[model samples]
Structure formats: structure tokens, C-alpha cells
Target: MIFFYIFLLLFPHQICQAEVNSNMEGKLLNDLLKDYNKMSRPVKNLSSPLEVTINIGTFESFDLDEISQTISVLLYITVSWVDKFLTWNPEEYSGINQTRLPAGQIWIPDLQLQHTPIGSGMLSTESNAILDSSGLVKHTPPGTIKTICQEMDLYKFPYDTQTCTIEHLSFTHPSNELFLRLGDFTLDQNTFQSQEWQLLNVTSRIEINYYGGPYPFQKHIICLMVKRIPNYYISNMIYPYAVLASVAGLGFTLPPDSADKLSLGVSVLLSTTFYAGMVADIVPVTTSMPFLGLYCLVMMSLVAFSVVSTLAVINLHNRGEAKMSYLQKTIFLKFLPSLLFMEKKSKPSQVQRNTNHKGKVQVETLNDSSKEVEQEQAKDWKFAAKVLNEFCMIIFSAGFFIIFAYTIFFL
Candidate 1:
């Protein structure tokens, strides 16, 4: 009998609490939907300046195409606004905090990028919008956009800087009807850094223009300045070329008479062609070559010149006295040696014995004297060839140094 009385008392209390909760939820929904006819046009707030705020949620990637001169960026674009008709008082509704409603249930501004090549239409999503008690609505849509990037300067290539922009405006609404202002910041600075590019900064600009008419058009442009990270090119393109250039110089140190000198120079020339092709694959095909490409070209020219000089040295080594000219002898043996700072051992002059029994002197025949002079001339020619090799080494070494220094600091 006592248990039956306790159950009846508790049943009424639970029923009353359920009834109050149900009424609060019903009243909140009824009030929120009273003026929320989605099909009805709200003329009262057409001039209320639908304050739009944009933010980035996730920046996936940014790719640049040199041939087309375009940049493509993948981003999660968030557009927020306040819907005056979607408000409800949380205190009056028993703290019925917020609601998730279909985007078709409310008015949304038609926003689009001005000159975007992709993702230019309405942002369609199966996701719902968050409607708070304060009437604020936030929706994030993921999209990819391809836009023009005419500021890619490849003269420095691999170390170049480029600025790309994204512009947006109301597709259907004019400045008087609707206005878009930048949010607190343009991009999500924490996650905008790219793997291959260092993002410098993002700046926003707004322009209002009227073509001698009553209505004005507003445009919002966001410019992104980015510099490429060149560590990949440095390791694969630059350092390898430097190593090859130094290796080509090693040919000069080899003996001029050896057959390997010409072979080494020719091998380096062929190897440079391979690297040049690799670089050509990466760089844009145009009339102007980058500084790194020029350095490669100059290095190849130097190696080819070294090969030609080696052939001349071999010819000089094999030349007979009859074939060798007097001018060649004077220039290579005297002038060139002095100019190149080379020292040659001087042969002792002929000393005739004058210890005769009765005041007599001894003289060698012309044929014997001519042979000795020819031998000394041959030795001088060989010495000059070696000096020529050393001179080329110095010239090529200096050329390499100048090319590298200029490309590094001047260009």
C-alpha cells in the first residue's frame, strides 16, 4: 500500500516536467519559424548591408604552371553572415542553445571570385549551417581555384618570387544592396605556409567603381607574395654543375702528351649536355635563359675550348723542326714563357779547349753545331707546351670563379 502511494506522487511530478520541456521546445521552434518563410523575399533588410566575413579553414595546396602562367590553390572557404529572421531567445526557450538548419531555409548572398578559372559558381555543400541564438550563420565550403599569376619572374628561377591574387565580389548584389568586408585577417596564417614556397604575406584591397552610373561595384582582391624554396635546385642542379666544372679543370693537370686529356674534356662536355637537358625539362622554354643555365653554357664552352687547346698541344709535341716555324718558336719559347711566369733551365754555352801546344784553337763543324741547336729548340718547344697547359688551367680556373661569383651575388 505504501509503494503504490509513492509511485503516484512521483508519476505526476515526472509528467509535469516532461510537459514543460515539450512546451519550451515547441514554443522556440514556433517563434523562430513564424517569419522564416524561406520563399518570401525580405525587402525590409535589402539595404541592411549583409556584412560578410571570409576565412580560410584549410589551405591544401598551391601549384604554379609555368607554361600557362597560372596558379591553382585548394582552400576551405568560410562565409559568415547574420540572418535577422533566424534569431531566438535562449533564456525564453529554456536554453535551447542553437540549431542546425538547411541552407535553403534562409537567404544567402551569391558570392564569387571575379576572374577565377575554376570554382566560380555557387558553393554547394550537403553540410548544414550553424545558427546561433544571436542569428549568426557560418558555413565553410572547400574549393579549388585557378587564377592568373603574371608576376612569376623566372630570371632567378628556382629562387624566384611570385605574387598571385584572388578577387571576389557579389555576383548579383551591387555595393548598395550588399557589401563584403575583410574579416579580422585574410588567411589562416598558421597553416598557409607551403612546402615548396615560403609565403611572404597576404594583403587585401577593396575598390569601388562606377561607370558614370548610379550603382557602384565593389571588388575585394587578396594578393599573396610567395618566394620559392630553392634547396631542391641547389642540391640537384647547382652543386652538381659546380662539381662537374671543377672536374673538367682536372684535365689541365694531366700530362699534355697523354691521350686521356682529350678524352676527359670530351667526356665532361657530354656529361654537361645531360645536365642541360635536365634543366631544360624544368625551366620554361623561352628566348631568355636563366643565370644558372647561362653558367652551364659557359662551363661547356670552356671545356670545349680546353679540348681544342689539348689538340694543339699534341700537334706541337709531334712537330718536326722543318714543319715548326721560327715565329712559333720565338713566341712560344720566349714571349709566352715570360707572360705565363714560367722558368726554363738555360743550357751552358759551348766552351772550346784552348790548351794547345803552340797557341791553337778548336772549332766544331757547322753540321755538328746545327744538330745541337735543333735538339735545344725541340726541348724548348716541349717546355712551352707544358707552360701552355698551365696557362690554360689558370685561365679556366679564373673563368669558373668569376662565373660562379657573378651568378651568386650579381644576378
Candidate 2:
């Protein structure tokens, strides 16, 4: 009986020892699984050292207004990825440790990504995704993967920097507005709502390449889009037009008797005409009138006035008769003379008498010499007329050439 009891006690001890060994093994396996889960977690470290490259593609612009004040841009981006290094491996684990480890997986979750402009301007778009397209993967495990993100936004400026250059910027007179769309990892959809965005200044498209995996085992391509905002100066449509019209209006200030009137008027007219043609050449012809067109028309009217006034002055001098008619003697001679002397003279009697006699002599001399002076003035006027005619011819020729060249080349 003592022998049987000893046997039973030894068997219980062995069973207990076996259970303790099993428990220890379970604990070790659990620890290894915890480590694997920690290592396989996705993209928690953005600032981790990475190998990256970027390439940009063609950009296109669209006008949303008649004046070309508002515009939109389309851009293409291409990115390439290289080899990447991963730190932890599921294959390294053995036996029960493998079962305990969470499924070997890595994924980026809830990534708050944005393409920020380091230079200047605000993007005019909703922070949403529009199109997300990916290309085919080449290699097998831990291979190259490329991702494309697209977005549209409005931009405005006083640019903060001048480092990067964007191609195909469109602009027009009176308003300088711009539009653009860009993206990196996320896509923007229905972002072009008018009420949500204001005018923009500039736009940028960018591309980024990512290298990941065990020191050098994977590659990825990321595309980024950016748009810049600009501050705009708003004024009346008539302000610029009025300023140009006033340049032609200066011809009216010339004295009627001055021989330079015709030359001055013709010169002003030609210059204004050239400016008008320049404006016309740059803009498309439309049924609707432009502020610049209004300005040119106003200037032409003033030129017409100058031409008529010159003709009238010449006609009046050509009729060189000084025989004081009732109208001329009564109104011009008598009334004009009385008006000048109505105020008392601040001079001695002798000086006053001399002044009166001088006035009489001057009037008589004017009557005698009027025809000769008229003939001399007429010659000066004729020279002016010839100069004006020549100027008009030159202007016409220049305008014709400009029109012809524009049609042949630009049109």
C-alpha cells in the first residue's frame, strides 16, 4: 500500500510540472505576437526619412468671363516610386508565436493630407475628391505602386514667393483673375461652386515619389496639386477709358490763331488712333461694346471737332474785308472798346492821353494792315493743313499694315 501511495504522489507532481511548462510557452508566444502587431502598423511616421522625386506635366487655361477676368486651369502629373525598406517581418516568427501575431498587414488609415502652397495664395475649391485612378502594379511582394490624386481650387495673390513657375497663365485688361486645381493623395469633387470661392492669383501642380520597404524593397508615386490666391484691385470700366479719351481732348486747348493747332491736333489724332488700333488688335471683335472702344469713339469725335474748328477759322480769315459792317462796328468796335475803359485808370493825365492816342493809331493801323496780316496768317494755316493731311495718310498706312499683319500671323 505505501508503494502504491508513493506512485500516486509522483504522478501528480509530474502532471503539475507539465502544466507549468505549457503556461510558460503560452506567455512567450503572446509576447512575440504583441511585438509583431506593433511593427506591422501602417504609416504612423510621416517624418521618417524617405526617398522621393517629383515631375510635373502640361497645364491648360480656360476663360470664364468675356473680359477674361476669371480663368480655370487643367494640369497633369506623373510620379515614380523606388525601392523601400521594411523593418519587421512576419516570416521571421516561428511556431505558436506566428499564430499569436496579428495578421501581418500595413495600411494607412484616416490620413489628413493636403497640398499646401509654401509661397502664396489661397486655393478656391472644396476639400473633396473627384477622380481617383491608379495604374497597374508590376512586381510581386512589396513592389512598386503609384497613386494619383486630383483636386480643383480657386487661388488669389500677392504671391508669397517666386520660386516655382507655372506655364500658360491667361490675363486680360481691367481684371486679373486666375483659377487652378491640384492634389496629392486625395481627389477633389464638386469643388468649383461659385459661392464658396473668390478669384485666384496663381495655380501649381506637383508630383512626389515615395520609396519604402526593407531598406530598398518597394516604390510608390504620389501626385500633389496646389492653387494660389491673389488680391485684386477693382475699379470702374470707364476709368481707364476716360483717361485715354482725355489724351486726345488736349488738342482743344490750342489757341485758334496758333499755326501749330492743325499739326498738334493731327499728331494727337494719330497717336490716339494708333492706341485704339492696338487695343482692337489684342481683343476679339464681338457684338457687345468694350470700354476701350467707347474711349476710342469719344476721341474720334473730339478729332472731328478739331477739324471742323480749323476749317471755320480758315474760312473766317479768307474773308479779309475790314469794312466795319453794322454788326462788326456796333457790337465789336463800340461795345468792346467801352467795356475795357469802364474802370478808372491808375495813371497820370499825360499817360492817359498818350494811351488814348495810341489806341486810336492801333485801330487805324489794324484797319489798314488787316488784309496783309490775313494773307500771311492764311499761308501759315495752309502749311498746317498740309502737315495734318500728311499725318493722316501716314496713320492710315500704319493702321492698314498692323491689321494685315495681325490677320496673317495671329488670326
Candidate 3:
């Protein structure tokens, strides 16, 4: 009976041990199955089949200078890709064998790229191409491992390349507009549409920078640098002022003897003043005066001289009883007569005349021939004055018209 009790205890312990062994074996088998499944799983394989194309469009220059040329270009880029998964056991999984992944299934987040001219010179061969590095490329798929369908780059690209064909290169002087052509490109045999690009308006100033190098054989180095300068169409505002000033200056040539001299001077001065005010309204007050300002100033000086000269001429003419200096006599008698075509005539004879009181007094009477000659002299002076006045007016009018016409049409 005691032996039977011992056997029961030993049997229970053996059963417990068997159960433990079975549990361990089952766990080990499960672990092995899990590892095998992991090893046999299909592996994701991603590849990018790159088809690159560049479509360079027409270049437009908004502004340009001697040293640097600002240009713009349209770049068309198309990117595509393929996503595939390697099947570990295609025979085991019919779905895996049948499934075909679409093209461009893999995503490329973004493309960061740059273009540099392939030349030795410091000046970039590309006149108008500039690229911004920040956020250059953006893919449609939002998440990690997102599927990529297709990518495209459509915008202006700044750069010049020898490999690219230039089309429609043209330049307009003074306007500073330049046009150039870059190469055309296509993706996957697709037709590329032409693009038009306009560059930024730029005004540049160039300067030479010189450097002296150390060593006896070293040569002086010179480098050209360009800086952008801001500009405006101030010429338009200045031209009108210049024209008005030139027209006003014509008033100076009018005859000094006329009563209209002061009137004309005042009228011209007021007119020019109005024009100057108009010019000031349009242009900013800067330290440096423009070319038009110089012209106006010169006109003002001439007008002032005309006023003084007119006063002097009137003073000389009115001083009739005043004894004239030799210089004055020479100018009035010799020079004036020659210039005005006043010819000298024979003197009248002296004659005797009787008064009402019966006393005879000797009186001088001009003979008929001498009287006729005196009248002719007076007529000649009047005619000469009229002719001189008309001549001056014609000249002034012609000059004023010319200046006005130029300002209106050509300036």
C-alpha cells in the first residue's frame, strides 16, 4: 500500500513535467513559425526611372546695363518613377503573381538642383537665369512612403547654357529691353509648349576694382564689378521745361527801342517762371541740378541782360540835349548811319526875310531840294527801324517754333 502511495506521487510529478515540456515545445514551434513568416514576407523594392527634360522658353529683359544683363527663362521639367515589390513565393500567392504596380508608384520628396555656366570667365554666360533654392520641388504625396504619380517643373529659369539653342535674341537701345531664346525640351515624347518669360527690370553700374599682388613678377589685377542702380523716366518731365526755357530765351533778341520791350520781357519771364514751377511739380528736389535746369538758368540770364540793354538804349535815345561823348557821337552818327543806310546831303543856303515891323532880319530857309532831302532822311530812319524790328521778331518766332516743335515731337 505504501509503495502504491509513492507511485501515485511520482506519477503526478511526471504528468506535471510532461505538461511543462509540451508547453515549452509549443512555444518554440510558434517562435520558429513567426521567424519563418518574417523571412518569407515580400520585400518592398523602390526605384526611380528618371526621364528628365528641359524646355527653355523665350527670354525677356526688362532692364539692362553695360556690365550685367537681367534675363528670365521658362523651365519645364517632368519627373516619373516606378514602385515594385519582390515576391518571395509567387507560386504560393496567386495575388502577388497577378498584381502589377502602376508606374510612378514611389515618391520623390523634392529635387534640389542648380545650374552653372561651363566657362572660364567670371561673367555668367547665362544672361537671365536665376534659380531660388528654397522649396524648389514639392511632391503631391503627403506622408512617408507616399506614392508618387508624376512631377513637373513649370516656371522661369535663370541661366545661360551653351547646349541650349538661343532663339529670338533681340535688344532695344535706350529702352534696354533684351530678348533671348533657350533650348526646347520634352518628356516621354510629349510635345512641349513654348513659354514666354519676362525678367526683372535692372539698372546696373560697373566699376573696375584693382589689386596689387606681392612678389616682383606679380602683375596688377583688375576686376569689373557691377551694382544695381535705381532709375526713373525723369527725362520726360525735363524735356518740356527745357523747351519752354529755350523759347523764352528767344525774347532776348527783340529790339531794345520799342515800348513793348518791358512788356515782352515781363511776359517771357512770367511764362518761364510758370514753366519752371511746372517742372518743379513733377521732379523731386535733389542736390544736383539736371541738364534742363542749367538751360533754364542760362535763359534767365539772357532775359535779364535784355532788360538792362533795353533800359540803356532808351536812356541814350531820350538824352537829346545832353552833350554826347566822342564815343557816343561816333556810335550814333558814323556807325548808326552806316548800319541804317542814312546818307549825308548838301547843306541849305541862308536867305533874308522881312518881319511885320518893317525890319529886315537874316533868316535861313531850306531850299525845296534840301527840304526834300531832309524828308527822305526822316523816312529812311523810320523805315530802317521798322525793318530791324520785323527782322528780330521773325528770328525770335522761328527759334521759339523750333524749340516747341522739337519738344513736342522728338524730345
Candidate 4:
């Protein structure tokens, strides 16, 4: 008897379920549908506009295609409206509070994105609507759509901020019939995160405009402002350029007599042009050049300057003492060396001897020996070449530093 009582205590709910009718849910659905169908046109016949509130459920993906200047996104959209006819008191319906029905069975707002990119159709998944006791109908539909919005100001490209808009409108219904508005918040905070982008903010507004059609329409535009995460760009784009710039700067320090000095400069210039082509392919083809592009041009110009300066130094080094002009000796040997803070080459010690009354010998040190001074003067071309190398190193170093600092720190 105790065993029987224990089994009954554990299995009472299962036994009761077997006795209940399986058709209760179906009966409730049938009753709800019958009442829902009786209300003619659900609020279309009413004088007041139907206020539809929309919220984004999930921001699945956001991508910017720089070449095409388009943004592709995958979004889960939620739209809610109050339908007076679709209501039923939960007390009257066997404790049934809410139910899910096929979306086709209910009247839905014909909302769609108007500025989608070409060849990219609006994709909507088969979804359902939730009908509550107080007649609140909520439908969340998932869509993967590409939008066409151009980001022209790419001056800070690879570190740029872009705003892409998703504009929605009712296709067949006019503004009087369907009024659209944003919900409390446009994006779901928990689901709105990106890997390559920082989702800055989302703004929403409604605009009434006529699209050359008979009736004017209302558009709900949701603008997403995002800044690109620069980690990838820094490593792949700017870092390599920095390394190449350093190599180009090193050319200024190489001896002018080196056979490879000019060759090195030419190689660096060609490399910059190649990188520019790559950047052109990635960024939008616009008349306004970006800072990165300007950086490339400036670097290439400096490299060309280095090459030309190398040639001039080589010519100066090859000129004989008899052929060297007075201006060349003054500028390249005296003024240029002083301007560049180059130390003069070492010279041999000068000796001066004096004989006194007791035949004592004394020696005094002059500045330098006359022979050594003359020899140093004879090698004016060598001194000039050294001056050129030092001068270029100082000037190009400053130029490279200023350009890099301004572009990186200010921008």
C-alpha cells in the first residue's frame, strides 16, 4: 500500500495529462482566428495613423567594401504595432496567455529598405508574430541586405569614420496609413559589437519625401556611424611604409662615391610608386588624396631628391682642383661644413725651433704644419663629398621626422 501511494505521488501529473483533451490549443487558435477575422481591415479603416515602432534585434554583420563604396549588413529587425482586433482576455481562454501564428495569417506592414545596392535583393526569413492578451503584435524578421552609401571623405583612410544609412519605407501604404517611428533604442546594445569596426552610434529619423510617385512616403532612416579599427591597417599598411621610408632615409647617409647610392634611391622611389598603385586599388578613386597617399608622394619625392643630391655630390667629388670654382670651394668646403657641424679632419703637429745665446734649443707648437695644411687643401673634393653626405643626412632626417609626426600624431 505504501509503494502504491509513493507511485501515485510521483506520477499524478502524467495520469492527469492523459485525461486532458489534446485539441484545446487548436480550439483556442480557432476561436482567436475567428474573432481576428471579424474586425474588418484591422485598423486600416480607422482615421488615426497606425504607429509602428521598430527596433534592431541583432546586428549580425557590417562590412565596408572600399572599392565599391558600399556597406553590407545582416540585421534582425523587430517591428511592433497594436492590433485591437487581435486581442483576447487570457481569463476566458483556458489559461492561454499568448500564441504564435504564421505571419501570412495576420496583416503585416509592408516595410522595406529603399536604398539597397544593385543586384542585392532584400532577404527576409520566414518568421512568426506573437499575439498577446492585450492585442500587442510583435514581429521580428531577419534580413541580410546590402546598402549603397558613399563615404567620400577618406582622408584619414584605414583610420576613417564612416556613416552608412539604412532607409526604410512602406511600399504600398502612404504616410497617412502607416506612420513609422524608432523605438526607445535603435540597436541592441548587447548584440552590437564588431571585430574590425567600433560601432560608435546609431541615429534614427523620419523624413517625408515624394519619390516622383503619386503619393508622398515616409522614410525611417537608421544611420550607423562606425570607425575602422586600425590594428590591421597599422600592421599591414602603415608599418611597411614606415620600414621603407627608413630605408630611403638611410640612403642619405651613404657615401656619395658609393656606386649603389643612386641605385638605392631609385629602388625606394619605385617601391613607393608600387605601393601607391596598391593603395589606389583599395581606396575609392576620388580626386581628393588621402593623408596616406600624400605621405607616399612626399616620401617618393624625398627619395628622388636623395638620388639627385647623390649625383651632384658625385660630380663635385670628380672635379679637379684646377677645375673647381671659387664658389664651390667656399660653399662646399667652408660654409657647408660649418652649417652641417662637421669636424675638420686632423692635421699634423707644427714644430718651431729657437736658438738662444748659450746654444739652447727650444721648440714651440704652431697650429699645424704648413705641409699638412697644403695637403688637406689639395683634397678639397673629398672634403666636399663628406660635407654633402652630412648635410643630406641632417635635412632628410628632419623632413622624414616632421612628415611622420604630423601625419601620425595630428591625424
Winning model by TM-score:
4
Tell me, by lDDT, which candidate is best.
Answer: 4
Q: What is the TM-score of each candidate against the true structure?
A: 0.76, 0.29, 0.33, 0.77
TM-score attained by model 4: 0.77
- lDDT agreement with native, every candidate: 0.74, 0.35, 0.35, 0.75
Ranking by TM-score: 4, 1, 3, 2
Per model, how many backbone clashes are there? Answer: 0, 33, 7, 0
Clashes of 2: 33
- Tell how far residue 60 is off in model 3, in angstroms: 9.4
Report the C-alpha lDDT of model 4 over 1-411, residue by residue, as the tens digit: 999999889999876664442355566678777746632446846777787888765686788887777787777678888887777777666567788877667777777777676643432437878878777888887556687875557888867888888888876777777888778664665675567887888777889988788767898888889898878766776767767777977886777668888888788888877887887777777778877788777777777777777787787666644345799878887898888777667655557789999999998877576666555555777778778877877777788888778767777
Model 1, 53: alpha-carbon shift in Å? 2.6
- Pitting candidate 2 against candidate 3, the one with the higher TM-score is 3
Better of 1 and 4 by lDDT: 4
Per-residue lDDT of 1-411 in model 3, one digit per residue for the tens? Answer: 999888878798777767766665444334323433222212232132222222322222212211122212222222222212221333333212222221132223122221212222121121212111121111221111111111111110111111111111111111111111112432221231223222222111212222332211111111111122211223443355455545544554555456776676667667666766654553334345543454455555554554454455445444433445577546555665676565545455545475757676757465557566555555444433443343344454565555445434443
Off by over 4 Å in 1: 1-49, 56-76, 84-97, 102-107, 114-126, 133-135, 144-146, 186-193, 209-215, 286-288, 322-331, 346-361, 366-381, 406-411
Predicted structure 2: lDDT: 0.35
Clashes (candidate 1): 0
Query: Per-residue lDDT tens digits of candidate 2, residues 89-204?
Result: 33332222212111123111111123222222221222211111121111111211111122211111111111222331111100111111232432333333332133233334
